[model samples]
Target: MNQVGSLIFLVALFLFSTFLNWYVFQAYKTVLSGVDSERSKQMLNLIYWIVFGGISIWVVYTFHQIFKAGEISTAHQQVLNVFLTIVVTQLVCTIFLFGEDIFRNIQAGFSLLVNGKSETSFPTRLKWLSIIAIAISMVPFTSFVYGITKGKYNFTVHREIIYFDDLPDAFDGFTITQLSDIHAGSFKNLDAVKKGVDLAIAQQSDLFVFTGDLVNHEAGEIEPMIDIFNKIKAPYGQFSIIGNHDYGDYVSWESPEAKAENFKKFIKQHERLGYKLLIDEHVVIEKDGQQITLVGVQNWGKGFQSKGDLTKAMEGVASENFKILLSHDPSHWDYEAKNEPRKIHLTLSGHTHGMQFGIETPLIKWSPVQYRYPNWAGLTAYQGRFLYVNRGFGFHAFSGRVGIWPEITVIELRKK
Candidate 1:
């Protein structure tokens, strides 16, 4: 489903961005038609189209990243957006062109103060420079799209559930490493993924976990990073679960056999990486006679259908053991884990990679993802329950993280 949704998003953005580029091109042509010098106007118009065309593509890439998490209405008042964008874009271009003029004039004035007139004033060429600026404004976006095409890291959370800090007198300063939402096939190949894996190992975590999104759609994409993931050495072993991206629900398949084969290969890859893939199951990790029940379920969502069977996963677990959960989507922590019959003490998740971009500050930090999920990233404690959201190990297709760098959460579980 994740794979198909991503494709749908890409297609939608592709269409939408193409329409916007056409609009910009038309506007540029209209402006050029009225200019006194047709030849210069035509040259400037061509430049405008190229630059804005590139920008439209970059905007489309950003839209694609945001749309995959949920259904968004791109066409609602799109005509208005185009018109407004063109007007505002023109204004921006005019400001830059005029600002350059003002700066040059100021510089000339300074020279005149020292040497007088400097060199003939150069005459006013401001007539059509605004058009040139309008066209030139799109260059940055074009370069950005090219950058994304080169490579992007779409990583999931590392959902490690071991004790991190002062652990119940029985366990002490235990560290758990976690990752989530690794959209494997979304890009060409792994680049900085090894750095992420090595960073996870450097935390000296006791246990490691990967909560889901192991593949974009086809499980074979999981093969490339097996060796890198194997480097995540933990004393208690690594555990994992199926995220929405894991079930092969997105693309068409000729037969169940082919799909099963794809799924098996990914499973084998996870095994080779030394991870215990838990599907709606429980594992008991013991230390000093005290047991921590690690419950992992399939995917669950607030709006989307629940693929995870939370109840079934914890069926055989003892009531006395302290429970920790590995649920992919943050919504699971908000709705299910907190209110579960057994009542989980801590929950770990990674589906929201903070949408791979946003602003963070000492006073307050926020990502666009926060509007959807309550605890989008970082640690949240509520009603004595704890959830740690790993910002994630890699990025999505819009790869570069502005304020939120790709992260590997090293949680030191403290027993208070």
Candidate 2:
């Protein structure tokens, strides 16, 4: 955006944030009114100002750097993300308090109209409502704290049993473990990261496939975790494909040569991590006397990079083959894989990361990203072709995950 537009947007955000802080302060003052502990009240007041002051200073500093650089650095962006998480979560708590206040006001209005005397006078706070508000505020506060501390590395294995009528008896009960979007650059906790990697290794699936996104922007990011990633193994083999981030497209480079060099390094990093980097190529997995085709293409999506070539990948494969295609973005399944004449039985993807935050349970699953991508996560099918978008092995911009924890997907192939 232009400088004027950016400044205006920043000012508006600051105003809104200030208003929320004021609302929080007012509610807090009323809540602490009946309490006798002066020290508790003082501590609360100190916390309120410290958090607000820190956020304000962060905002000003971030905008100043953005204005000077004409773009935000990764560190600045991460700081903004962390700060916004706190601000937005607190704002949500404030909104709940406002709702309670509105309800109490309505009740008072009704009492005044009916009995000519309201239960409480104007500006009188309901102690119960205030208490409820405080309790409600702790929900997001605790949840966010958990997200930062434990949620990111809390890897869970999601298993799916998919059956096909085109029976390959030899391949029945075959297990394939998929891990995608290991944005190594964003990892901070080495021990926690190693724990997640260990979980993936423990699965012991017959085959392992890393759909895409080995690094966030450059290959060097994966250097530290090279040994940890190499621990992941399967009897059949481990294969991988490129994602948009692997190309180093998001950041500016000193020259075209540097960008090309970075891309080459990313390729080598995949090799170092023991992934048979496939680029618009096909491989056959043979077990006993049956065979299934596994094709991989470069990163492709409707709105993303268009380097993947399904036609090239499926060159020698027949239409009747039990093909499992690996393309990073789930959108590729919608636009190309499912529509291919040579039917792709299953497509693996992991670009969305379910926005790295959402409520996913057996009963109710929902994420904001669902509105943008039809095949956002989990198993989705179109015209009998299945697409499984792994929730991702790691996180990205947000740095932490909430309800949507890091995922390790294990798919068992059953012949119907």
Best by lDDT: 2
RMSD of each: 10.0, 3.4
Considering summed lDDT, which 10 consecutive residues are worst modelled in model 2? Answer: 117-126
Provide the overall lDDT of each model, using Cα atoms, as 2-decimal numbers. Answer: 0.68, 0.85
lDDT of 1 by residue, 131-210 (tens): 66666765434433433443234333333344333245665666777877766664345556775666667778888888
* Residue 54 CA displacement from its true place in model 1, Å: 8.3
Per-residue lDDT tens digits of candidate 2, residues 187-287? 87888889988888898999999999888777899999999998888899999999988888877688999999999898888888898999999999999
